[model samples]
Target chain A: MKFTNFLQISILLLTLTFLNYFIVYQKCPAVTYDDKTVIHQLSKQNVNEKIFFITPTYSRPVQEAELTRLSHTLLLVSNLRWIIVEDSDQKTLLITQFLQRISKMKIFENFEYTHLNVETPKSFKTSRRDPNWLKPRGVWQRNEALRWLRENTTEKGIVYFGDDDNTYDLRLFEEMRNTKKVSVFPVGLVGGLMVEKPLIENGKVIGFNSIWKPKRKFPIDMSGFAINSQLIHDKHDAYFSPYVPRGYQETHLLTQLIHSINELEPKADSCTKILVWHTRTEMPKLKKI
Target chain B: MKFTNFLQISILLLTLTFLNYFIVYQKCPAVTYDDKTVIHQLSKQNVNEKIFFITPTYSRPVQEAELTRLSHTLLLVSNLRWIIVEDSDQKTLLITQFLQRISKMKIFENFEYTHLNVETPKSFKTSRRDPNWLKPRGVWQRNEALRWLRENTTEKGIVYFGDDDNTYDLRLFEEMRNTKKVSVFPVGLVGGLMVEKPLIENGKVIGFNSIWKPKRKFPIDMSGFAINSQLIHDKHDAYFSPYVPRGYQETHLLTQLIHSINELEPKADSCTKILVWHTRTEMPKLKKI
Candidate 1:
């Protein structure tokens, strides 16, 4: 090729490459539509890896509100399969309506989801007087999602345990999307500390910044780590057990999922910044109107 | 100019214009940065219009969680200036910490925010048995935000009243960004109805879908509308009044701001879809350890 012609073609190629990058990361802005029914959302059409977001929820005064807020945030993320396991024998109307309404929007037209219900046994439930942390909650609900994942698909994806009320930064999903083993990040306002994270040494998970249960093997919150779907398939016996002691659920799950703590991949700039928060919504006190 | 040269230049101009549209309507993906510091958000740099989002927040068990979630959503939008007014004698440490920490993040590098406070008088505050509708709420706090906006800027912008807890669709901001006058959209789950919105005729707001107090001038939820900042300048006395009867605060403000109901502009696909929701957080029941 002539030198001048090569230079001109090179410039065009570079422009195309940069613009392609711009489209994928900026979130493809939803296409404009006259009818709100066919609205679109900024999407990740160029990316291939998917996320399986598992959430356990129960009926509460703010259940609809919490789910609605959470659904909006989740919609911002692309390539996500929302697997909501309700803490009830059957899926409630509130959640069904939420999903159905959200699915009707054209912006979320391609959004994938699964709604399931498996009630937590009464014996495992926390009493009004007892502190909520006294028992390991969502054991059965999460297990049901796990059973679904194993039985339903052999797809390669990332599995994250998300809370209905917790705050999530969109960047958190981007960091977790590439998890090779178990990707770990910081959880803010957790365990009375501003942040709890896996201490990274040369990008290896050496220890944790947790003050509570410092002696536990994993020493992480449930929101702290995301596993490759391969881990779930590899460890059929891995499950969240209610029989474990308080604050041991994370350690128990991590023990079964990994060969060693070193297998953890540190994300969100090696846990220097918190991408998730362990936030709990207050139960509202109400009167029958 | 030669016809052949003019044709080549015209083709190039067309390509540039098309590329600009793609970059804009397609959200410009944030640039990559290795440091957790100096992170960037998908921004609307090409658009000139700005949204001044005024939010009223108070101390509650879920206050931090609510702010964190709302902040994340706001960070996704470009050209937005957040004005937060606290319902307290002075801004609480919790809110201070929330803003300061968020400001430190690079992903929110270009985010603009203002925080102020004004206490709700004892008479205006609702008691536990008052059913929350007995007295007007957020009147003083929202007024404080308005005063701040008027004092701080002479820029042409759209002003919106937002709550710390309500669910917001990201598209809601885009719909309101170009308001020439009052722009209204549907609010979901409000006033014991599934959706409440401005009834549109031709292109103007003719009436409303409200079941409660349909005769009111602007029978809409507080989360339903946006105004051009010029309207705030035009209506000096237009403010959310505490003296209004139950559910009349919206009507009271609209009465001052508009000369005729014909000035109202219908948005969010002419009020066909719910872009905002009146979702309240459940107060948490916590036991002292």
Candidate 2:
């Protein structure tokens, strides 16, 4: 009777183990790849410096729609990795599933990405009714991406803050690719100006042409600049600040990373042509169910 | 001895049954709904007539992006059902999963949709090199939707052929909802015309303002017309022709459905406003992997 009991217990344990394995297998099937397939395609780029597009995003009604439009534009470029940091306590299954589906597409087969989530403190978070410009958002999320880059990346690359809602022209990526230290460009439809541009004199960025507040050292939007990876790595303590004033986020962060104003390299034909736009989609009126 | 054998077999059967049930339950969990939940929201609309938007789409690099944009616009309207027919041999998992996600959103909680796939014949399918106008597309897919509507839908409704690539203003849906018979409107940037419009005289469509072959009965694009569901059911065999001439698609189908121009109801403020655009997204330039 003792032998039979032991035998039944052993059989039950074996069955449970096999069942667990089968369930896991069904949930995540094996991904078959050819011999030439590079799992992380960003590490295999032949360029002198890769471009890391860091976008800090949050959950909203238009989150997936905005990402879909942006992904279509980004998929055209080469040697680029998208670092998407979400504003959530934990990584949501919706976003993870979306990123996985996009990554599997043939057009994005060579694309590389990293998904990170860092929740914003309740005090710093703004209400939905607040105007976007009045509230300083994406501060901690951007810092988290910068922190990840500093800890994981050692190779040469460029870091750019690409807001999900902004419209990007393909030529802007090419300009950032050749960035040596810090590149600046013209951003259209921003700061109540036709173009908030980097004022270039003698092929160097002297000042900014922003109409809102030209008093700051670097009066540019988030999409207006790109920093070299080496510079970011060298300046270990530089990151975006949440305590800064409404419009001082850009200036406050740039001052820490750059030793002098001369480090700013004007791009997009000496900041004469607008290659990017601060265009925002109008909120769709959804009827109450 | 026989009684013991029977007991052993019963135990084995029970164990197998429990394991199978556990595996199936793990694969697909249940979805809970409250009393206020709207399962088939399309059937709950108070409107006398529903609008069925039939869109024939194929898998492309920008398929999801285009569909997402279209969904944003369509979600704003009430009493509408989107019939997305895929031009493939079988329904793809990608399209099915995409529809499921979109339908679950709060903004689209009331949106209803049907997914169907009908493969284009090998001989008629055009290559990528061919210009869009040269190839007659969406012929069979539209027919499949019409057939489904005839067989499945018995209530009063309006059927409109909406292309996935076009841009629709919200006002267009309101105009289509009040369609009496075959509603005619102006489609902007179509057939190399600034606006292919219906020339109204005394609240009736007299002719077309189209520069591209105005001799035809209805010189408008696919997005410019909406037909009553009852008329389609009465015709019994009316559908788009795959063998029509390069520019005769709209005319060939309209002639079969409408006996005279008097039956057309001019909409969108007497067909003056260009509420929809025949806009297309340019193909992204991606490097070969």
Candidate 3:
């Protein structure tokens, strides 16, 4: 080759070598469902991780729609089953119809509105002065859903009790898939109680930022948690209790399953970006019955 | 006088002097209310101060008996008006009749079930594929109660939103009687987030031990606070908003009222002792239902 041609070829080889090393060194950024392409790319990655989207649904249809949209959107990306328990008066035709749309999803539509009119029991003459009667109902409904899952699901999967009113991000499941035991993440629209997770150090969960009640067994809310199937299968009862205090629903269940926060997986990927937010839709002023 | 008689008199004088100095130097230990006599004795000491027993009731009649008993018991000690707001669906006739028996006590029965269910527009279909018809409902019920009190009540008294499930010691009200602004004390059964209150120094309110969302406008629970009516009257819209995030209920309202934690009065007298706790009663298991 001529001297000019040799110089050009040598420069091209150096550029090619630099590009190869750059590809090897740089890792891919954490996946966020910023758009459909990201989700499609995630789906094509080929991980057969089974995710059990254990959600607790009440009468709110708007929330149910949100969950269904989330599930259907997620089902396209991976092997998933939505173990949705309806905490309703009865399994309504409406909820049944909604669940039919989500493919590869199992609908557990059964609940009783046992704690109707909490005020009636607190009435001086009617209640005979019993203070325990004022507790909100439906804690057992969550337990019932949990029990049903343990008995029915033979496959290994992640379990999460997503309340009906909450706003969820689809990417949350992908992050939780690798959780060995129970994993915790930040929830947005939860006022300023942002980023509740185990204080992890060198891959070990140390403590929690549950400043409101740090002494409680489980300081996080139902939505802020994701437990491994093994944890659920290990426990005999594997259920929540009606006897637990109002906010103790999450705490009581966590105590039975995990030894310490060290057992919990902490995901702060979306911690800066609010993933799941505890947003309750407002009760509209009805124009007269 | 005889030498024996003079010695006895000298000993008696010394004993009286020691007792007088003890009473002046070390204030009497808070008279325990293990029984009714202690309550009666305290009632006589503070007879001139008008007692306002504000009980925030809910639908559970059985749970509210403790609150009703406290209200009734307070009536015996001094003039107390039970500002009982029922967190119910309708005006309960039984609660109305029960309040009638208490003399000089005003029972305000109001119903606002904001937490249990969110109200959506009828046209808001269950599924979003159809159309966007969902509208959030009754987000201002608690704010209405606060506005009603501000607009109506001219009397300067202590205001407390005592939830139905809570256990209250009658002496707690007396402790809060002289509160100029807002006073906070520890509550039992609320140790999950142990000892939430204003940080005080030299009998002045400073800040809070709020580990959660302390930065939120109001970061306190309903049961953990008691404010003078003037604060409510001054901060016109300082009531709660249902539309806000779940835990922001306390913080949101507090931010709108006070400029700083400096305005809050800390009652550390019972800080070591849990007084008004955020205890939610458990759901009872009914085999038949």
Which of 1 and 2 is the better model by DockQ?
Answer: 1
Please give, for residues B1-289, the per-residue lDDT of candidate 2 as tens digits: 3555645755775576567657544432222112222212222444457789999999875566567657656654566789999999999998997787555432222468999999999989989898766778999999999999999988888999998877775557667876766999998666666577888999998888776676777787899999888888888788888998877887888888888888999999998887776766555433332
What is candidate 3's CA lDDT for residue B123?
44
The per-residue C-alpha lDDT of model 3 at residue A108 equals 11
Q: Say which docking band candidate 1 falls in.
A: incorrect
The 10-residue segment with the lowest total lDDT in model 2 chain A: A30-39
Tell me the tens digit of each residue's lDDT in model 2 across A1-289: 3556646755775576577657644432222222232212222343457789999999865566567557656654566788999999999887897676545432222467899999999988888898776667999999999999999999789999998877676567777877888999998667766577887899987777676777877889889999999989999999889888888988988999886678998888988977676656544333332
- Compared with the true structure, the alpha-carbon lDDT of candidate 3 equals 0.52
Cα deviation of A77, candidate 3, in Å: 4.9
- Tens digits of per-residue lDDT, candidate 3, B70-179, equal 44334333334455555455556756645543332211111111122122334422343442223222223344456556776687767676654444554566767776
What local lDDT score does residue A52 receive in model 1, on the 0 to 100 scale? 95
Give candidate 2 misplaced runs (Cα > 4 Å): A1-289, B1-46, B106-109
Which lDDT tens digits does candidate 1 get at residues B1-289? 4555545655675576567656654443322222211112123333367788999888765576677788767765666788889888987887887786555432333467888999999977988777766877889989988888788788888999998888787668878877888888998777667677888889887887677788887888889989999989877677888888888988888888887779888898878977677776555434332
DockQ of every predicted complex? 0.15, 0.04, 0.01
Q: Which parts of model 3 are misplaced by more than 4 Å? A: A1-36, A44-46, A60-77, A102-137, A270-273, B1-289
What is the lDDT for A200 in model 3?
59
Candidate 1, residue A137: lDDT? 86
Worst 10 residues of 3 chain B by lDDT: B106-115
